[model samples]
Target chain A: MRRADRLDRLQSALDAGGYLRLKDAARLLGVSEMTVRRDIASCDGRFAYLGGYIAGGLESAGGMGYILDRERDAHIEMKRTACDSAATLLKPGETVFIDCGTTTTHLASRIPADSQITVVCYAMNIAEIVCKKPGLRVVMLGGLYHASSASFSSPESLEMLRGIGINTAFISAGGVHESLGISCSNFHEVEIKQTAIANAVTKALVVDSSKFDQVKPAFFAKLNSFDFLCCDDGIDPARAERLAAAGVRIMLP
Target chain B: MRRADRLDRLQSALDAGGYLRLKDAARLLGVSEMTVRRDIASCDGRFAYLGGYIAGGLESAGGMGYILDRERDAHIEMKRTACDSAATLLKPGETVFIDCGTTTTHLASRIPADSQITVVCYAMNIAEIVCKKPGLRVVMLGGLYHASSASFSSPESLEMLRGIGINTAFISAGGVHESLGISCSNFHEVEIKQTAIANAVTKALVVDSSKFDQVKPAFFAKLNSFDFLCCDDGIDPARAERLAAAGVRIMLP
Candidate 1:
C-alpha cells in the first residue's frame, strides 16, 4: 500500500477507536512496530506512555481523542447549545465570574469579542479564549488549581471573591433537583461556586436538559439563587414551568 | 481621661507590641477585664483564644491606619517600587502572564484600563484586578490552589500552557544567584515558571534588588532563560554587570 494510504487508514483507525497503541497500530496496519514508529516519527507525532501516537502540531488535536470525540457527540451538542444561549445575557462592559465546567467553557467561546467586558474565571480553557479577545479583560482567581478541570478552587478563591463584587456569574452544576437545588461532585467547587454567587449581582445557571434529576453528592445553593436558567429545548415543559414558578426565568434553545 | 481616649491607648498598646491577653489590655487601660470586653464590644471587636483580638471591621480610616502601622516594617516600599517598575513593561494590546508574588501583585495595579490586552495569571489578586478592568482580557490557569501565596500551580497549568503561547511572561523568583540561576521556594511555582517561559516568546524576570543574593530550595531555570531582567535601581552595579555579562539584558528603573 502507498504510504499515504497507510497513513489515511491509521488516521481512520485512530479517529474511530479514539486511541491506537504502538503494537495495535502495527497489527492493524500490517507493519512492524519499527515501521509504525518510523511512521510516527515521519509525521512528527507525539507518543506519550499511556496515550499513544497523538497527532503532533495539530494545535488542539494532541489530547486523548475520546475527549474530543465525546465533545462532538449529539448529547454534548445540546449542552453546548444551552451554554451558547446563556451567553447572550452577558452585557457589554461588565465584569463576569465564570466557574469551571465543560458546559461553562462552551459559554466562554460564545462571548462576543466586541462586548468589551472583563471575565473572572477559574477554568484555564475558558480563560485562554477570554485572553485571546482584544476587548475583553480576563481575571484568573488564584487557589488550588485542579488538574482534572484545569481550574483553581479552594478556600482562597472564596476569600478572594469576598474582596470583590461581580456584575454577573455563570455556573454549572453536576446535578439539579427541584428541592435539593444545585449540586456538585466536588466540595471545593461547591465552596467556590457558593462564594461566587454571594458576590454577584446576577447569577445564571447553564446546564443541559439531560443533567436534570441527576443529583451529585455536594449540595451548593438553592435553585432560587439563580436569576436565569438556560437549558436545551429537550427539557420538559412541565419542569420548565416548575422552575419558572420558583422565580427562575427559563431560556430554552 | 475620657473613655474613648483610654480605649484608644489600650488598642495602641495591643497593636504596638505582641498579642495582648484580655487581662493585659485591662491592666494597661486601668479598667476591669469586663470594661475591656465592653470596649471591644463597643468597637465591635472579637478576641481569639490564642490569636488575640481578631480585628473587627474598622472603617477605612482606622483600617488604613492599622494596616499601615502593621505592614510598615514589612517590604512595603520594596514591593511598591517593584510593582511600579514591572508595570512599565506592559503596553496596550498585549497578553501578559504574571506569576504569583507580592512584587507581581504590584504590577497588576499598573495595567492600563484603556489599553486592550488579556492578562493571564495564576494569582488571585491579579485576577481581581483584571475583573475590575474596563477593557482587558484576563485568563486564569487552573491548578491546585495554594493558600500561602494565594496562587494556583500544578501539572494542569503545564498541560494548558502547552496548547497556547503568550506574548510575554513576567516571572518572580525567590532566589537569584549569579551561579545557581533563578529559584523559587516551592516546586509547584518552579513548574509554573518553567511552563510560562516555554509558552512565552519573551521572558522577563521581575525581581527586587534584595533578591539578588538570596537562595531558595527549588531551581526553576537558568539565568540565561530570561530575555530581560526588570529590577529597581537598588540592584548593585557589580551584580548588574555580571547579569549583563551572562547575556541577560537588564532593565533598571
Candidate 2:
C-alpha cells in the first residue's frame, strides 16, 4: 500500500479505536508491523506507544484540554446509553455541574427541553448546547480558555466553581477502577475535578465501559468519592459487584 | 430555480447585507420583487421586512443577541485592515475588553501572538481564538449564553464586567453617526455597554463604513463617549472629519 494510504488508515483506526495495538493495526491495515511502526511516527506526536498500544496524543496526557474527538465518535451508542441513564437523575430547579466529556455532553443533551434548571460548566461546547434547553440558565465558568475542551479550567475557573452550589456533579474520568480510583490524563484538571466533587451535594462519575479497570496519571478522586457510577452494560459483572459492595451504586444501561 | 434554492439565495443576501432592500435583492436574485416578498416569509422568523429590506429575525432586534454572520463576511478585507489598525493600540501587560463582533474578533486575532496582555470578552469565538495567543490571559464573561454571538451577556455578565478594570475598551457599535452618536439595535446591550464605558479607562468605537451614517433604536453613548473611532477607509472624508472634530480621532484603514 502507499505510504499516505497507510497513514490515513492508521488515523481512521486510532480515531475509532482510541488506541491502536501495533500487531492488530498491522493486520487491519494489511501492512507489516514494521511498516506500521515506521508510518505511525508520521502522525507526529499525536499518538504515543504505551505498553501494547499507541494512544492518541499521549503527550496531551500532560495538561492541554482537547476533546478526544476520535474516541468520542468511537462508542456513540454506549456513551448515549450511559447518558440516558444519567439523565434520569436530573430534576427541575436543580443546579448541576457537567464535566467536559463525550459521555457528559450526551448527558446534558438528554435533559428534556421543558425542564427548568441551572447548569454551571466550564466547557464551551457544554455551555453552548445546554443554553438551548428551554427554561435553563447557563453559567460558563470564566478563566483561562482551553479551545480543545471548549471550556475554561484553571485557577480562576476553579475559583468561580467554588462560589456556586452544585446539586449534582457529574464527573468525567479517563479511567475508573475499583482499587486504583477515578483518574484523568491531564495534571491541570486534577484540582478542578477535586473542587467540583468537594463542592457538590451529590457526586457521580460518568464513563463508558471502555474506561473501566484502567489507570491514568493524575488521580483526582477515589472510587468512593462518587455516590454512584453510570456506565454501559459492557462492564464485567464481577467488577460491578465489587464496586457496588464497596458503596457506590452501579447504574448500567 | 427550485423553491429551496431561492430561499437559500435570500438567506445569503440577508446574511451578507444584514437587511436586503427588496428591489435590490430582486435584481440580484433575478426574480420579481413580488416573488421575493412571497418567498421571504417561508424563512419562518429568521428574516423579516424592516422598512424597505428583509432583516434577520426582526423579533430578535428587540433584545436577543446574534451575530450578523453573513454581513461580517461581506467586508473581510476592510474589517481586517481596521483590525490591524486597532491592533497597534494594544499594549503589552494591559487588560482590554473586546465586545462581541466580527470586527472585534478580528481585532483580537490581530493582536501580537507574543504580547503579554489580558483580554476579557463575552464571545465564545473571541475567547476560543484569543486563548491561542501566547502570554495572554483570557477571561470569558459568564452569564446567559447566546449561541448567535457565541458569548455571555446578561445581568450577571454585566456584574462580572463591572468588577474588572479594563485599560482599554474596544466597543462594537451597530451604528455610529456624528449627531446620533453610538447606538445598537438591542436594548439589553445598552446598560452593559454603558457600564463598560464608565468602567473603562479608555474607550474606542470600532465599526465598518456600512454602520456609518445611521442610528439604531437603542442609543448607548454619544460621539464624545469614545476617544477614537477605528473604521474602514470607505467611510466618507466629510463624516470622518466631523467625528474627528468631535474629540474622536478617526482611524481609516
Candidate number achieving the greatest DockQ relative to the actual structure: 2
Scoring each candidate complex against the real one, what DockQ results? 0.02, 0.10
RMSD of each: 25.6, 15.8
When candidate 2 is compared with the true two-chain complex, its DockQ is: 0.10
lDDT string, candidate 1, A1-253, tens digits: 5666566455433321124456777887798888877776775532222224332112121121234345434455576668756877889998888877666766776677689777887654455445545466665665444434545554444555666678989988889989877898777787778888989999999898878988988899899999999888888989988889999999766
Candidate 2 at A146: error in angstroms?
3.7
Whole-model Cα lDDT of every candidate shown, in order: 0.64, 0.68
* DockQ-derived CAPRI band for the predicted complex in model 1: incorrect
The candidate scoring highest on TM-score is 2
Which residue pairs in candidate 2 collide?
A: A46-A57, A123-A151, A124-A150, B124-B150
lDDT per residue as tens, model 2, B151-208: 5665556667777899988888878777767888766667778888888998988887
Residues forming the 10-long window of minimal summed lDDT in candidate 2 chain A: A57-66
